[model samples]
Target: MGSRFVNLLARSCNGGPRHFSLHRMNPANLFHPTRSAVPAVQPLADAPLPPPALSFGWPGKKGELAWMNFMAFGRTGNNFLAVDQIGRTFFYDTDSRSLRTGMPMMCKPIMDPISIAVGDSLYVMSGNPGPSPGKHCFQALIHGRLPASDTNDWSWYSLQPPPPFVNDIPRFHEDEVKSSCGDVPAPYEIGAYTVVGESQIWVSTAGAGTYSYDTVSGAWSKVGNWSLPFRGRAEYIPEHNLWFGFTPNNLQLCTSDLTASSEVRPPVLQNMWTDVVRPKNWTLRDASLVPLGSGKVCIARFFVTHSDNFEDMSAYKKRENFAVLEGVEVLKAGWAHLRMVKHKSERYVFGRDLVIPL
Candidate 1:
């Protein structure tokens, strides 16, 4: 129920600094900056807050990284991509959290887009119309070379009549592709989407079940281990690999072949750890996975978590400030950089990723 985020936005249109009208659960922690180390400090004895991490660049456009509706990617802190409430998406380099500019023409009206970093390309797929569920749009990870050959020429085109929708698409491939093949994968499988080992697509469903899409054969198959439970499973791509969230209940991470695999696993955090919060019904909140320098990645996991029982609805406000999870890669492990989207007052704060006191 704590879905609505960003009481205030970045580059706000106010006279002073941006002000917000939302409450968040940011644990109290003080920033102790040393030589490459952030020693943590506690405000009181009750809550032991973690330390802070290196401040990477913002994961937004115009050097802006404050968008309520955004998304990010992965473990090593290498890639982080974000999509604002509007349809615009941003790709940032993790090291500096800096925006990378090389591939041009990234404007499109994609609703719910699935991202995958295959080989050298960032494939973005699916999206119907409006914010509501509808049709699907397809775009290539790698841009085709245009004859014009200008940096500005780099962009994606709309591939309509895309993978068939779960409802309207055929049940079997023999009837569709005419290959005498078995069941083929439909392009659209509702909101179910996944990325696996470099390149793969896995779609999870309640009725149709889990299945993988074979890009080459142009077919689909029921996923292995049908026994695996599916609660609030969601998928996204920032860069490098595919990300799948099995049961939003704790949201243990699992990876597999691009075509979907039977075995699934949980992801190790930047600091390689998990807290006491119970993850449930994960909606693709604000995400932006960017790679910092020195093999480090920073992912701002902006999703929501709730009690196993619907008890503590206090945090569930119709409006809330920007709650972000900033992941920073450490020496042997990784550290999370948690802080509130600072207000001009610097009095109120939002909480999440915090570097541990060492």
Candidate 2:
């Protein structure tokens, strides 16, 4: 096993839990099921109410605060996917919300990703990609599959998609192929996915450009050569029989069959929410893909920061008088002023190691 897989081995497998198997775990805790999708869990009354299975719980670490953005990882069990820090994808079992067994598929490091999916005997699409500082450089639109039962029997391939164009239509509804979302201040990471069914491939990219590699042909095309809007990332809701975006602030999106439309596909969004995790002063970085159960997703995001003036005018005034008497006299005293509140009681932030969900 690779180091990444090995390190998470005990927690993800062996000593911990295997893929979320309906036949294995508590059946009463499932979320729900999508069309042609699997059920993630059976509704359990005593368990913590999974906030609608609509919240996409995005996880991150800032200083000492481990920020978690959540959405209902809906029960239909086919849309959710996770791309670890490294470029690894783990398909989650819908009924169990656990990763599929024996799959640590060899893929590139997706810097940040949000969603993924597979169809037509191929990994049609894998994640939501974009141009945030937190997103990945997204060099290769690679594709391949391992022996269903053999990890060692894996195959890999690379791709070369086209460059990006401008979308200047303005506004989410009137969005052109070149409008820039204020959300992506700078290219951070690209980690999210959307489905372009008409093309028979799932396109992953925002602003950076569209990419759909034919698993069978091993060819990469910038078919939908428009912008991957920052307002939303790709998501397939099996239950709704539709595709959506996992943007922050509860915003849901609809995708065009990039394959069917002759012109650039128009992206539709639901004002239900928007990306709440806005950066202070960040840019596009990178992204990656992760497979939870029903399908997989790419988390494309960038590192963000905030700043404020902290100079003490009072101290400076005193220093002016001292300096007037002698150049050696100096004055400087200040400290950060900000209020922080934590919701979780656990002092330790990395609860996965200690909590052991599976």
Candidate 3:
């Protein structure tokens, strides 16, 4: 059976080695059909919690000089890439928690970029060449698998510039430059990207509009206005054919249709939000919502809080909580059916970069 992994980056509070861990989960075991039929806030620590399959050092440091700034990340099958502050990208085998040999990306790294894996390929958009000469609004596709041994290598090839709708947005002045290929428009800073079915990738920029790229024909089109509270961070729940967005205080839903509406139906960008049950005395840092095998959803949240509210931010401690919600229709989620199933204490000062297999 296929498994899903949650990847997180963190470090010890006492200034120890930074650690990256991948928690493995088999969605089939995440829920029970015969549990309480009504909605109620239950303690997650009472249920069985899945453990980490792989944990290791965070890439980027060689000596005593590493600063550990998270740059970007993407996953292709069991392999995941972690980009460091200096623009170096390292690949790891999630099954073994081992690093694979490979050269870093050809361009300099910036901030949040649209990164995703489709089949055997990893596609990265924007966040390259670090906006010096110009904002590099380009896309690159890394093909092939990890080298058979330490001596072989994979290939990174740049794709054509994103379509007009992407480059045409007024976020930045369009720069026309020639790469090794030919004349192309610079890449725009992409806030998030997600796969839409089998043939398209949906992108939300740092501001305003949302766009989609056709994988088969290599074309781009404006999909909808990005007015939702959360942009790229929203996760798709296939069972309901809807997108789920999260905040510390609420959970929101919207149609997964990637098209702007004209006359027939309302636009999917308009979202309906609902309050969720959170543990007392916990402040959320990051969270992820992934589909559990049979019409169930697992919501994983990273939280932090201080022994005393008057203390400095550095005094806060971190923990993770997991909850399961089942059988509630998305449109009619007036009262949540969520329950806490697991909890883990994190020794790190903090955590970020919640990556789950798509």
- Go through the candidates in order and give the clash count of each: 50, 133, 7
The deviation in Å at residue 217 for candidate 3 is 3.3
Per-residue lDDT of 272-326 in model 1, one digit per residue for the tens?
1232242344333433333333323333344444334456566443222233433
| Poorly placed runs, candidate 1 (over 4 Å) | 1-91, 94-108, 127-136, 147-153, 159-161, 165-192, 214-246, 249-358
Question: lDDT of each structure?
Answer: 0.36, 0.29, 0.47
Strongest candidate by TM-score: 3
Query: Could you give candidate 2's per-residue lDDT for residues 1-358 as a string of tens digits?
Result: 0001000111212234322211112221221233224323222122221222222222333343222211112223232334444444444444454554344533455432333223412231213223322222223222344547443332323233321221211123323233233343223223344555433344434444455555455465555545444344444434233343444333322232223344366443422222223334432222212222232222222221223433865533222100000000011123311111111110111112211111
TM-score, candidate 3, is 0.63
Count clashing pairs, candidate 1. 50
Worst 10 residues of 2 by lDDT: 320-329
Models 1 onward score TM values of 0.43, 0.36, 0.63
All candidates: CA RMSD (Å): 12.6, 18.5, 8.0
